[model samples]
Target: MKARTALLVLIVALLGYLAFFNFSTLAQDVPMSLGFTEVHGPLGLVMLALYALMAAIFLAYVIAMQATWLLEVRAHNKALQAQRELAEKAEISRFTELRGALDDKQTQWEKRVMERLDALENHLKARAEESDNVHAAYLGQLEEQLRNQPGKESPPALGQQ
Candidate 1:
């Protein structure tokens, strides 16, 4: 739509310029009214200047629109990048938290294992001491019985007379 409007404006300006420069030739066929006046020197120059001004204004508008589009695209990309960084940081923090919890569990398990091992060692040592004491008491009783027995006595043969 904008292209068609620009083309129409250009065609109108070209026809006006032709009519202004060759007024006598164009007027030969068409009847002129009292109100119609031919465009002359200063008026034609002013029209041309106005046409140039309109073209410049259109060009400036196009440039401004393009600049605004580029700026908006840059801003969108920056926002996307910031969101990605935030997600990555959140993932890293989650991993760290999980690792810390795992380490804590491992330490607790190790402590419980050491405590059980210490208790088993103490129980076995006590049992060994009890067995040694029982053996010593039995040996003392055997020696006392032997000493109380007689040292000499008459003995009978198989078929004693």
Candidate 2:
């Protein structure tokens, strides 16, 4: 059992014992006064009744405080759960934003790479065309020279007269 419960039981038992011990005296009639009137009652019993009334009020106050504390704790837990949910949503949004940004960057990088590759292909094609033109011109010039020197006899082979 809880310490508070134990202490409350002990106090109640002590009060009961005291009241029982004074029961004989409490049976004797005495005079009591209120502001508006006077009454006759057993003095010990009146005092015991008053003590019981005060104990009841004190117990009620304690119960009220405990109920208030429980309500506050419940409210606090609800607020904490809300905050956690909010944080989770925020984190998910952040991740989504980051993912979108990465995708955009990846797309841009791919576009740039494709454009560079196209430019390189065009440049290489142009270079190949220029090389072919130069080769064709050189062959044409050699054929013309051969036609002009036909009457002078073709040049001998390297090992022949």
Candidate 3:
């Protein structure tokens, strides 16, 4: 399935074919020297045995590497998940705090606007009262002047005219 696996299979098939064809040569005895002793053995079989051992060792190493990598990736994923949760909580907290601040500002603005309106209403009422008093005084002076001058039929009173 994988390139390395395919190549390994190819190599193994070629060796099997070679060994099958050369059975006589592989069976012939040859002297082999171990570091501790010397012995006569089938050289081809000995070489095949060594190759098998090396393949087993390589397979074991590959399995170990794959397992270690998987565990490291799992740990990294867990850490990322935790970080994501923390970030979401912080974002929610900021949104809530901002909402509270905006509400407070809106309330303050409403209070200030109401206070301004009340002050303006009071000022307009005072001005209207002052204008009424001034008009009344002018009418009283006109009436007094008419009385002192004796009868020129006095002009009609203010509203009556």
Best by lDDT: 3
User: What are the per-model numbers of colliding residue pairs?
Assistant: 0, 0, 0
lDDT of 3 by residue, 70-155 (tens): 99999999999999999999999999999999999999999999999999989989988988988888888988787567657777
Cα lDDT of all candidates, in order?
A: 0.74, 0.88, 0.91
Clash number for candidate 3: 0
Candidate 1 clashes: the total is 0
* Deviation of model 2 at 1, angstroms: 6.2
TM-score (all chains, Cα) for each model: 0.48, 0.66, 0.69
Ranking by lDDT: 3, 2, 1
Error of 2 at 86 (Å): 2.7
Q: Residue-wise lDDT of candidate 1 within 37-99, one digit each (tens)?
A: 753344444555677689789879989999999999999999999999999999999999999
Cα error, candidate 2, residue 104 (Å): 0.6
- C-alpha RMSD (angstroms) for model 2: 5.5
Q: Model 1: how far is 152 from its true place, Å?
A: 11
Query: How would you encode candidate 2's per-residue C-alpha lDDT over 77-147 as one tens digit per residue?
Result: 99999999999999999999999999999999999999999999999999999999998878767756765
Error of 3 at 123 (Å): 2.0
